[model samples]
Target: MQLWRRFTHRLRSRQAGDALLALPLGLIVVIVLADVLAARLPLGPSLLIVAPALTASFASTLVTGAIAAVAVAGMLIIGLDSHLLGTVDYGSQFFALLVVSGVVTVFCYLRERRARELALVRMVSEATQRAVLRPLPRQIGPLRVASMYLAAQEQSLMGGDLYAAIRTPTGTRLIIGDVMGKGLTAISDAALLLGAFRESAHRQADLPELAAYLDRSVCWNLAEPSEVETAGECFITAALLDIPDALPLIHMVSCGHPPPLLLRARQVSALRATKPAPPLGLGELTAAVYHVDTFAFEPEELLLLHTDGVIEARDARGAFYPLAERASSWTLHSPSALIRHLRTDLLAHVGGHLTDDAAVIAVQHTFRQTPTVVHTTDDSA
Candidate 1:
């Protein structure tokens, strides 16, 4: 039954395209009849060239060539019937139509070839992004979560922004960060930091220790000889959070990253770190010391973690997006609903385009009895 439906759908689509393709031929027939019946008028075989030129825009090279052939044949028939086949005027028209159709066919082939190459490149980039930036589960431990990533580069799937969540014996630990620059270098740095976090998040005893381990990893990884060129200025701003299942307290360490916002009972406030340290990869230069900042994270409250790209997005007038102001209205929304609203509103504020890549994760504290499985929903649109 499914096969029958699929076959019928394809048949209908092909029939529609076939009907659309006949338009150029219908045009050729009309022009030929006009030239034959009203020989005195300026209407002649000159207008037949329009058929093939029009077909090239929407049809394949084969269909375009076939239409061009039909058009040329129509011109010959008109010229022979009118006794003008051998005249210089009719000959020039024939040659012009032939040359124009050939050029259009060549262009069609080149365009399709480039399009196929572009599609292949896009597929590869998307696959690499999935492997590096795996989506966060909807439910982990005692929290409901939602995540989204928006790339600034057109047709790009990955960027400098990164995030990950790992379950520990005591609670859940999550990391969100952004590399310094854009392009391939930023993506490479982000992947490196995420990998280091996922590997050490479980082994590290505390938030400060985990943060220090990540800092050392970034610093050492970027200092290699091969990366010396960008290593001088390479750094990543990150925020790490430890949420305990039984406690209402949240432990965090900020590394020159934007502070996450807390939404509770129709109020929104930024959870700024009191003793924030320098961004990762610069710990050696700055002699940075990580500190744990505890905050009250009771059940039924939502926490919003995002890259700077979100707050930095500008409108036509160059005004930055007011994330906290806009989020105040959705304080009662669930994690998923909050993310959906934020994504829509953010895009609208930037006029459907962003100058920098953005990554967002919304977490709601909840107490569920049953064990939770990974349910990830990513908005790459």
Candidate 2:
């Protein structure tokens, strides 16, 4: 898949370069014809310099040099044909074209060098993000999961928003969080939290205990003066969940994060935390106690977890995205299909560009054996 994508990208880039080449080449033909047919006019061959100048915008140094060479040759051919080869005017024009072409070629070289450096930086950034924010599996234990992340920064694939899932002996543990700030610092914080969650989720016995461990982890990491400039201010808003393979119930701990939405029978409602705790980093300072909130997560029902960026996204009319209202229509969709629809709808709401980083996870509980008493109530959470 990666090889095919790279091949298609290179093919498209080459085709674009070929299309741009026609502009300079066509200009060269037009200038050559004009100088030949209208020799008496003031239209001098020095106009040929435009060819190399235009080529430098999109072509590499080699291609620019080739076009420069063609332009120089055109100038010489016109001078000889017009019987002005030895004339002072033709000599100065020749010198000017040579000087300009050399400068443009050097400019093209510098541009290409800078472009290569930028590409290298982008590659490194992507590698680091992949290592830190690893992709979640499509299926974990008895849950079908789908996740997506949208970075607000152009050309960036990852940001402060993060999600991860781990399989426990009897259930699946999941987490979705957002760092307080943006850029590298936020990414670092997010990575730290995800690492702690992945390492401790299985070992922790319950949702509250796991949430407490995560909060302690964040508080310790951010308290380091070397790691965080504003150590006291940094915090992480997160939602942690443990979904048992046999039980149609979800145990969640919300750390100042938005509620997850439950989709069932064409109805959409929030699974709000009964008693939300402080954000992760501030938990120790406030002596916060995390509470476990149990919700009835029946089989075949989709639960959507998203960062604040999704709900805070504003349209042209300065209105927030109606996630619940829009998602009410997609209640019957599968986890992957629900994520696909939400991504499309969210991007459209924000006019194809998000103002902040957004992360989303869709989970559907699927079990082989149906539980005896299935609870169907909006107030279960």
Candidate 3:
């Protein structure tokens, strides 16, 4: 009885294994039969056969598809040798079958290789993003910060939009800027600007000095000897914010960029700079200095800094998305939540893609807690 049970178990295992392999094998068989029938019909060569054969080849392991191909080729050879078609040359039919099988195999191999390369590129890009945009802590001074940076192209790992926040003896200094163009040159320029900003922010006493420092650094380092004549032409639109410890005020210096958006309860407005400043690198020739604009930041209010990429993003209908109007309804509760909502809404507005790199930083002053109210009865006296 034990031996009988063992034999029955072996048979069941074999059946299960065969069932698992049946669907793909069946598909291959059907495709081969269809090809053979189509070839025999009045309809010339079986070009339709190539589709299923290539699909099977790419979707399954090379060995499995190779086996199927070999089997089909063998069947074709046998059919030809048996003179199945009247007055048709056997050698010619056999050669044609061989050629088709070879072509399908090569195509499948190339496609599989391309897929592997794409996956590798995606993995590298994700890794680079984490390295470049490290997570911001919950709070910086009185401000709660959250930010998002998105590349314009699908496969790109990085681009020109840049932002940085650093605590210094001067104050909590922040920068938001966009490089002139895209690709490797833009990334290079962005890195240069951020590096200069961080170094200068710690050392410089005021916003104007810091701006001048950055301008000089970029002018000296970015311009090639041959491009000296065009040095004044290249510049970055940047906004620098310095939050002082003494009062509930934020000092801002805008360099030809869009003004920061300020959000208070039920009201959203642009903290427009009173004096328009020339962009960095352009002010070197002119002795005129840029002035900083000051605005009050009550607790629970939000400030948004962004790049032109956000303002310039267009939808399928070719209309530019109005950031001010769209972000008006946003409630700044947490940095991550605010950024998440903005990213989703922005992508949806543009229908899944933007023509340029985009970035947004949302900061809220959370130190001044809301006062609690209590009711008192006056009628008791």
Highest TM-score model number: 2
Candidate 3 total steric clashes: 0
CA lDDT of each prediction against the hidden true structure: 0.91, 0.90, 0.73
Model 3 segments more than 4 A misplaced: 1-24, 31-52, 60-70, 73-88, 118-138, 169-171, 226-230, 244-247, 314-320, 369-381
Per-model TM against the reference: 0.88, 0.90, 0.75
lDDT of 3 by residue, 1-381 (tens): 999999999999878755645654555456556646665433222332443354544253464455546555545644664455444564455456566666666776777788899899889877865555444566887778988888886677568788888888645888988878788767767777888887778889899899888878878864788767767666777899998654578999988878888877656789899986877767767654779899998777788888988888888888887888767777545657868888998899898888899988998865554577999899979
Q: For every model in order, what is the number of clashing pairs? A: 0, 0, 0
Please write out the lDDT profile of model 1 over residues 1-381, one tens digit for every residue: 999999999999889878888899999999888888887235568888899999998888898999999999999889878888888988999999999999989988898899899999989889988889998989998899999999998888779999999999989999999999999889989999989998999999998888889989998887798877766488899999999998787899999999999999889999999999999999988889998999999888889999999999999999999999998999899999999999999999999999999999999888544567899888885
Q: lDDT by residue for model 2 over 1-381, one digit each (tens)?
A: 999999999999999999999999888888887888886345658788899999999899999999999999888778878888899988888899999999999999999899899999999989988888898888887788899899998888888998998899998988999898899888888999999999999899998899889988988887687867777789999999988898899999999999999999999989999999998889778998988999998888899999999999999999999999999999999988988999999999889999999999999988767558987888868
Error of 1 at 267 (Å): 1.4
Worst 10 residues of 1 by lDDT: 35-44
Model 2 Cα shift for residue 261 (angstroms): 1.1
Instruction: Give the Cα-based TM-score of candidate 3 against the true structure.
Output: 0.75
